[model samples]
Target: VNLRSFEQAQLVGSPFIATNEKNMGGLPDRTDDPTEEIIDDLVSGRLPGVLILDPIKAGVVAAETAIKVHPIRKGKSGVPDEQGCIDMAYNCNGCGNCQRNCPNDLDLVEGVRLAKEGDFSVLSDLFDYCLGCARCEVDCMKEVSPLTLLMHAGRERIRNETFNVRVGRGPIQDTEIRNVGAPIVLGEIPGIVAIIGCASYGKEIQELYKMAEEFLIRNYIVVVSGCAAMDIGLVKDDEGKTLYDRYPGDFDRGGLVNVGSCVANPHITGAACKVANIFARRPLRGNFEEIADYILNRVGAVGVAWGAMSQKAASIAAGANGLGIPAVVGPHAAEYRRMFIGRSDDDDTWKVFNARDGTPDQLVGPAPEHLLTTAESIEQAICLVAKLAIRPADNSKGRMIKLSHWIDLERKYKGIDLPNDLEKYIRVEADIPINMKEEVHEYLKQKNWQPRDIVDPTLLKRLCRT
Candidate 1:
């Protein structure tokens, strides 16, 4: 049978026979005997099953669609429910593609081969080498994303193999943050800011951490998870130890807590609830509601989920906003509009704010021009929230202020530096290698600008003038 017919039959779960005849002619010429070579190949075990016309075509089929008919060996007690070989093949092929496409040039293919051979020890190193960017998926013919799949799978295995995986109903162990000197002191603080999202390659996340540190300095409890959390070392450094080691006593009052993996982001919401619960006690309840009212009304506790496609972080932010918490997202303006409005066009719950000046007034207000990095976004969000919290008047007014407004007001209101230490960590074009630095400098110089500076020249003007 032809390859297409064979594929169709396989799809329909049908059994069909092939004959050594051209167009089903009873009398066959030697040249017309198409099945003879295939039959001989199959009988000699040179072919695994039926021989297709071409090896590349056959390999593509096998790689893309081969199913595990049966196990090569039985388990010690019984047959394992999971098909190990099939899993190995699928994962190995994906890993090969990942290695080929990796910009860092890591041996993802060999890593997966070793993993398939049952080497768990190398898994961590293999995964760590991944930039956690999904470039491999773009290059793959099968549309498999290696970084995400491997990270998730590796995390599951590590979680299962290391600690008896337990799901705590409430907050993760407070000691987790305590060890880092960034403990969650619930009622001790007025509010908490959660920085949630995926970590992609580039300096965006590093910038976010600097921002988080600034919030910590301001005594706002900060929670982070997922790749955003990982980017900030929440997974490995449970206690904010690394952070404290770098900036001792920096996080003494406010804390930086790493909840867990991406799945643990909702824990940030729970922590917020805990904060609400703490303030809801008798005398504090009125104050709490008042504070909640202020936060709900003026102060913003925003979540930034740029680079990640999953709208989970953004959704959580909206939920918090519904409960009187404010949120800021870094997704495209349209998506932000969708999340904000939901089904109702009349709902202007989230006062549109942006760091950029020319941002449409209907969707986003201006964000900080310098707060381009994910870390910066987080810090900026926290700073904005902190500013509103500090000002009772601003909170009561129900005004949505740009992050830059608070950044400008930082020194005046709180006597704190507006840019703070976060600016040091923000990677800019000037921070690139010396050779590359010249290129960036030249580019900006030609445009009469500096590195990291926004040049908003109109395309028509530039084109027409040139």
Candidate 2:
């Protein structure tokens, strides 16, 4: 079921139901005594095994009844806890910092502020303009981490607003899976690499597209999903081709596929499965299962997911890993660290994970050392993953490429240049000139100290004694 439909079912006082088998019935009417009828049917052995309902509605009712039953004591005020107030304050302050530092001038501050004030009318509006580049957090010294906060808050708002909403049924679109060109088929092309994640207040996911472009130049298929896809305008390619184009490269300069929204991450997994299937059928000495096992155990056909806060990415990684595919998450390390050690004001710890064995192998460090914004680290990790994908004994097989060479190539090919609009955001710090020699000489003179037949030309020149 889609999110909208699930939410609507909750709002209309209807019990949200899930069943293993179909053909129960359509939605129940509002006037019908659903609870009584459901109970009667259950008692008579006519109902199914399980039934579910929206817990939020029950909680709301319970809270309301409790408030009505127990009035606030004499001097006590009726309000949420101190932690809730702190969270509200933190969100407001962090969002304010994000807006101030945002290069694109997004109203993140206003959106979060509204959320704090229990106003969500503009929540979706705020999300629509977020580039998800994560630059806002990058520039903030307050350690705001607006991206995750926004996603959580947005999801909550969506839950509240869309509850009891209904979605009309529609036929599922049949999507085709095809290689871009003869190069892809002739073993001349590198396999696809899809970078999938969410776009919150930060723009960190934008780096995925940059990485994709680099991978594309090396003849690798590149796919992006979720809010990350939206940032780069992946919903539609430059040539107006559907996301599932026969030739992704031809449709969009080269090799960029936006699978869909967050839930559509299964598309990436399916694509990888298709590639594995094709590889398995090519009389390559191994079947699909064997190849999958090999890739899972030996070759690193790994999925790298950035921004781990979203359950969607975690779910996708689990599915892929279950299929014997290696997977890595960029943000889980920080989460683990935060879970273990409390957060510090100046700390910027980011984490990365390897979920190949269903056990997380985490890499945690300062953000500058581990996270995005530092291209060198990301490049190295990608190179390492690629190197792991190659079979050691196969001399004829092409080896995985190194990230250093890729980085060198990128540096050589694309010179340092900023976008025109971003020029205003650049600030040049002033340098103070200091004459060390003159200062030293002045100090020496003041102390009535003189060198014994020794003179420094630089010092003498600075002291006007040359």
lDDT, candidates in the order shown: 0.42, 0.40
| lDDT (Cα, 0-100) at 57 in candidate 1 | 46
TM-scores for candidates 1 onward, in order: 0.38, 0.40
All models, RMSD in angstroms: 18.9, 20.7
**Candidate 2 has what TM-score?**
0.40
- Model 2: lDDT equals 0.40
lDDT by residue for model 1 (108-210), tens: 6665555555554454565645555556656766544445445533665445633211122336443333432112221124345666666553345555566
| Deviation (Å) of 76 in candidate 1 | 21
lDDT per residue as tens, model 2, 329-406: 554423433211213222233222322222222222111111111112345445533332322111112221322223
The lowest-lDDT stretch of 10 consecutive residues in candidate 2 is: 424-433
Residue 74 error, candidate 1, Å: 19
